[model samples]
Target: MNHTKRSGTPVKRSLKVALVYLLVGGLWILFSDAAVERVVSDPEMLTRLQTWKGWAFVAFTGGVLYLVMLRQFQNDRVMLDRQLGQQEEIRRLSQFQQSVIDNANIWINVLDPDGRVLIWNRAAEEISGYSSDAVTGSDTVWEKLYPDPDYRAWVLERVSRIMAGDEEAEGLETTIATGHNGNRTIAWNSRSFLDAAGRTAGSIAIGMDVTEPRAAESTLKARERQLRTIMDNLPGMAYRCLYDEYWTMKFISSGCRDLTGYEPDELIDNRHLPWVDLMFADESDAVSSAVDDAIAAAEPFSVEYRLRRANGDIIWVWERGRAVEDDGGMVLEGIILDVTERKQLESRLSEMATLDPLTGQFNRRETDRILQEEVTRAERYGRKLAILWVDLDHFKDVNDSRGHAVGDEVLRSISLRLADSIRTVDTLGRFGGEEFIVVLPEMSVDEAWDVAERLRVRVADEPIRVSDGDPLTLTISIGVAVYPDHAESAEGLCNMADKAMYQAKDQGRNRTMVFSQVAGTIESDKSGEA
Candidate 1:
């Protein structure tokens, strides 16, 4: 803002003005001499007026110079005023920045490379329980603030490194023993001010109190550790695994030993073997496929299957897992528990519901369900299905003449004979008392009739050997009905087969009859009515 006024500049410019005046006056004297000589005859009169004329010429030139110079002075003054105003604004802005630094929520401290505090803000004083005077004047602030000598030295090195050009700036996290207020963790970004030659003048650090957040993070880690302890003691094995075919175990809880007869260390990172290898080989494919499907849908899955333990004992396991994608990779976390007992119980119950208790064949209820499904499938695909209604020709006679126990043996024998006669895909069920129903999928009426005849012959050829009685010959009559040909629905097909079996009985038992005879009669009636 300061511009020195040169001592001789004004005088020099004034001398230049005087020289211009003298040059002009000399010109006037030289040019006007002849005119004055011709105009004035009296010499005394001319001399008296000449002095006044010279004074007037000097005054006129001086007035013209003053006016032009005054205009120049006004412009210079305006420029000086503008410069002064700009300087004032700059000073105000500098003051505003200082105010912001002093009043900011974050603690600010400017320190010399020697660790002497140069500037301490109000926030620093409030947080550290130190006054501005105490902080700024004391070069040994770290003596009370950083109790550990090593820590104090480390803090001092932060600024010293910047000063020594080893670092430009640093982000610092440290703990400060704040007098009686205990300790506070601070996160700071420190930058050093450098002189023109790039030597560090001092360091300014802007920092925030991170004590609460650090404490919260500590609490969270403790809680997680607690939860992990609970999971380790649980009955089931909690596992986090890599998304691979082996379901490679990452973290296996302590329950692994009790659950799988293996220690946690033996399973983690697959130290002993892959966890997937624990499963039955076929079951492994099924479980991995299910897990992959769940991963594609971003969902969880549950399955029950057998696993071979380290003790070489096979046990059923119920596993539930969830797939999560992170960092463009996948992680599967799950729990596996021993469900061998539960699975055995369920299987027993299911078998009791589905299979015949006396004959060990499918019961009537399951038979109906299978027949309905086969009928629907045949209808949907325009495929054929056949129902064979088989009746033991003289089952009641055996039960009446012999004991019920012998009848049971005979029924069991006949069941085995019928079971051996049918293909694997066909279903056989006891149709209440002496009648057994057979469901043949993808079999036409002729094929069903052939099967029925074959089964009848099989039963009759083998004389059932009973402990109490002689070998008795058995005969079975069968009726065949085709789906969507004789009847459309499963119930309709069963009814048609039943009626055909009665027809076989009336035509003399031990024979197979197709339902088309009845259907032909119905069609003939309809034709006659038409």
Candidate 2:
């Protein structure tokens, strides 16, 4: 926009003006001289008039030259003013462009074809901690930014390829050592410009600092690894799933293979099977209801249910979960643990509390409970109920001769035979040592007598084989009592049955007796079995 201004008119234009004036004045002089000669012949007078005409021509020519020079000067002034206004506009536009570049937030730098820094903006200065004065017209800033020789070489090569149009510069990244900050990562985009002749000129590169974003990405990846480790180490399946009947899985841990005999990928998205399909059909409704209720209450849920594995084996599982809000809407997050072993242990403990250890029949306490329940049911329905009280005959003599182990074996064998002789609806239990009770519901007194006779025969007809001795012949004495016939209450009925049992033992070692038959007997008439 700046150039030297000439002080006066151009030499070529001034010479052209002088030539035109000479031609016009010469023509006028020749014409005037010819006309004066033709009009007058006197020598002195002609001389005088010619002198005047010469003077007049000189004056007029002088004025014409003055007017021409004045007009030329005015035109030159107008041209000079226009040139000045154009230069001023060019300077204003250049200043505005510089201001925009300097105020931009991103780094902007330009390099010459020889790799010298041509332009560096304020942002580049702030980011690199090198002022424009320090970086412009020099290439040393590259060494400061890339302190490592190998890295610098790579960066330079990449930039060269980009400037040569051999490689794209979009999203190109580099790590630089900053003057103030320890280090920074930058993402760059670049373009090469051309001169007026379309020849390769310098290049401009724009960069954004990405150090913080890269650091955050690294931290996020590390935490993801840690979370994966924890999930893999867990003994149960950890999951995040949609709250639907399919329990569509979004994420499932590696422990799923061990828990359900299905891989995580198999269960995710119900690729193989829906989570609900793994539960027992009978228990699914109850489990679903429990989970739904807990979710409705905005509380956590805990449920124990059976699951069928991929191998088709059923196992008990305990699940604890809660509804959680997620990007995909409400979902379930939970853990499911195998609880088959615990359930088995609980079952064993329950059996121990209510079953006879040696005979595997209901124990005395459980028998009493059953008797009371049956009595209540029969009374409510006006149904007949009967009980048979059976006693092993001469069982103490066997214990005294062959040891208690053999005697226990005989008792167990006899209990089994008695149990086999009754209907499935009848309840048989070990009432005490050498005695058992059989409860029959909806049975008349005569029907009870028949069942008691069958039980007595069933024991006497078989030989009880003991592990320590040869098979021994065994017999049992049974006494029968009917509800509402012998007594009203469970306890009274039991007493009547016991009296009948003692009466049978007194009458014979192997027989049946009714409680009514022994009720009228004198107390002194009751005797112990021989």
Candidate 3:
């Protein structure tokens, strides 16, 4: 619009100037010629006036031309200033875009159709350790970045496929060598486009180094494999479980077989078997409560309990574990080792401490303890307990003549018979040479007397066959004492029973006597006063 309007201005100015000149010149010519003719008598004088009119016309035309050219120059100057302002705006906008790309952390590359660099941003220069002048037009720069020819060919082939093929490389990962760093892993995003003339413009790729992250991923994979191997080789199952009533197993190691006679498949995620079912029925509540308490306190624990295996066999085990509760998502993780052998050994050691090696009965220490306990129980319940002090008749002669081995054989036989004659709750133990004590829990003196008589008959009627000699008949004299009836204390009662046994010996060889028969105080000597 402005160009069209300006183009018409020169014609308008010419028309106005032409009109003015025509008007003024017509008047001047008409009047001036008349005046010249009137005032001059000679024709030469009239010609001079006409000449002056001609000079005036020339001067007036020159002045009009100067004003018109000045106006045109002013209009041209305004147009030029507007054009300059627009060009400055466009230049600033282009600089702003370039600055943004240069400061971006990622490397940017722009190439021509021949793969020669057309643009390499600041990041590219900083990372590649080369200035833009060095890389922008160098065809050999691509080779320096990726040294191997075959690798370059492969990359070019791939880039070609991406540019021309139906499927393009949206986000491609590749490796490149840095001038100083040797090698760098990169993730690239590239695209091929058309130029202004609609020809292929090669590709532009934006890349980021991923060397550290890739190395971390590789290390993680290796660590995971190593942990899995350790889990597989464990002697017992390593488990992660939910803090549920069943202590549901979420994950279990392959060593589940060695500990529970079950496969990992049977326990993991509680598929077919729950961990709670493995505990002994009587111990389940105690064990669960204990673990819950530990978790509540955020403490670690070690407890011993019985667990039942798949084959219905029960074994003892020691379990140590910790509870990790974060954000209230409770998870239980720990190892369960097969400590059955250790438990068995402990049980054997306990038995050895309390049982006699020779007669397989309660030894002296255990018998005394049991006697004291039974007495306390009897007193508490207002009931009676019977303790029998028994002696063998003529066992010394057998030991002296035959051998101590024969005496041992006789004693073992007597112990067997006594054991058979007593109640299940009774305890029998050898007190000393030819002396055995039997403790009957919850038995009255009358009941104890019957038990004593049964034992006496069983022993006397039974004969022991010596290894080298003929069979020897044995008779036992028993003295019975009732708890809190004969004497209130174990020591006093035992003394009374001892006196009763000696009385039986004094009366005859084989007999049964009750402590009430000699209710008086009995001395340490068989039957003397204190």
Point to the candidate with the largest TM-score.
2
Extract clashing residue pairs from model 3. none
TM-score of each: 0.52, 0.81, 0.73
Candidate 2 off by > 4 Å:
1-99, 517-530
Write down the lDDT of every candidate, Cα atoms only: 0.83, 0.87, 0.81
Separate clash counts for every candidate: 0, 0, 0
* Distance from true location, Cα of 386 in model 3, Å: 1.2
lDDT of 3 by residue, 247-309 (tens): 888888888887889988888878887888888778888888888789788898677788788
Ranking by lDDT: 2, 1, 3
**Candidate 2 clash pair list:** none
* Candidate that would win on lDDT: 2
lDDT string, candidate 1, 1-530, tens digits: 13345767768988997898789888888766666667887899778667767787778877997897898799889989999999999889668647887788889988776768888888898788887798785787878888899988987777678656677544578899996589999888877787788777777888899999999999999999999888977779899999877778989888888888999888888899888878888778878788778778888999888988888999998889898775798888888889889888999999999999999999999999999889889988999999899998867889889989999898898998899989999999997888899999999866877788788777877889999969999787777888888889988998988977877776667878787654354111110100
Model 3 lDDT-worst window of ten: 521-530
Q: What is the Cα-based TM-score of model 1?
A: 0.52
